[model samples]
Target: MPPVEEETVVFRSRFNRILAAVFWVVCAAALVAIGLTYAYRPTGSVAGLAVGSVLIGVAVLVVLWRPQLTVSDDAIVVRNVLSTIVVPWNALIHVDTKYALTLITPQRKVAVWCAPAPGATAALRASRAQGTQARAWTAASDLRPGDLAGTESGRAAFLVRSRWNTLREQGRIELGTAGDQRVQVQPHVASIAGLVAGVVAVALVTILL
Candidate 1:
């Protein structure tokens, strides 16, 4: 028989999506407002357009673009705004959901930038509900309970834990082999440098004009 392919799961922040949408809308409105107020004066209009571009660029880079957590049978991928980190299943020691979806490995702890845990009050409520659901989780060990899936961070942690347990049972995760290979964190240095350069160039032009 052919080997079964592992399933891939993605966890993303609901609040972050809403926040990103708001940022995008705000940037669009700012640009529209600048265009509507465009005067005949070339210098003033150019400066206003430059300011609008700067706002759009900053919003796109910072607020409108958020991170994501992807879990698969073999590894977990953390896609932050400027960097991406890939960690193998065997390297993950624990999944924590205190302040965020944090992955604890033998070498270091990585926190997911997008999925932030709820506040104390909300978490307490979710925890109480999760406690009840956790007792019934044994029968459907492979599935995530609805109670525990209240928040993005909680859901991400639960998925990671479930995959970790499944992999361990299948003897796919070798704890002893952890830390043999370092996790890879790749930053989008060129993109960030270009953004910085654009901002500086616009600022210099605005000043000179």
Candidate 2:
């Protein structure tokens, strides 16, 4: 029997933009550092100049080359320098934050890492409670659950959670074990970065020598 598929909302956080920007800046700095080191050193060691130039050039290319993610009705696509992946909603048996969890489908699973530890959870809860209390001192108190839960964002989260629970009940998703079906999440990106970095390093070395 063909598996019954349901529509899924692929939610992406806005923080990725900030992360990309930071990475780009770092790449540029690394490149510039290599160029400067080659030009200014007292002892013109050809070997040092070659190595530095390569490192800097590679850094520049990595920053300039950015990867993007896209969402559609049928699948979530991740585009990187080396490769692209199209994971269908039906195939995505689960989605969890990075760390200690694996999204499982009947056919495959994705490994997640670096999730928040228990201490982080407790701190967040305490901070939220403190913020709520502080806000209650003013007339414009935070919106109560009744007011917000009916709103679109709140409702969406509720629906997603409910559906995820349903999937858990159906034995489609599990909490532990990295599944056997190993999918390379970003093969193309890694390959491209490595190649570009290598070429840039070689170019820098030639220029300095």
Stretches > 4 Å off in candidate 1:
1-3, 40-58, 61-66, 124-148
Candidate 2 per-residue lDDT, tens place, 1-209, comes to 53366565443323334555566576567657756675676343544554554554454344333444344443455444455555544556555422322344556543321111124444344335557653343226543221122222233234444665665566665454333333435466565767767766666555665
Provide the global lDDT of candidate 2 against the true structure: 0.45
TM per candidate: 0.79, 0.43
Scanning candidate 2 in windows of ten residues, the lowest lDDT window is 110-119
Q: Model 1 residue 187 lDDT?
A: 94
RMSD of candidates 1 onward, in order? 4.7, 9.6
Give Cα distance to truth, residue 65, candidate 2, Å.
Answer: 7.9
Question: In order, what lDDT does every prediction score?
Answer: 0.72, 0.45
Clashes of 1: 0
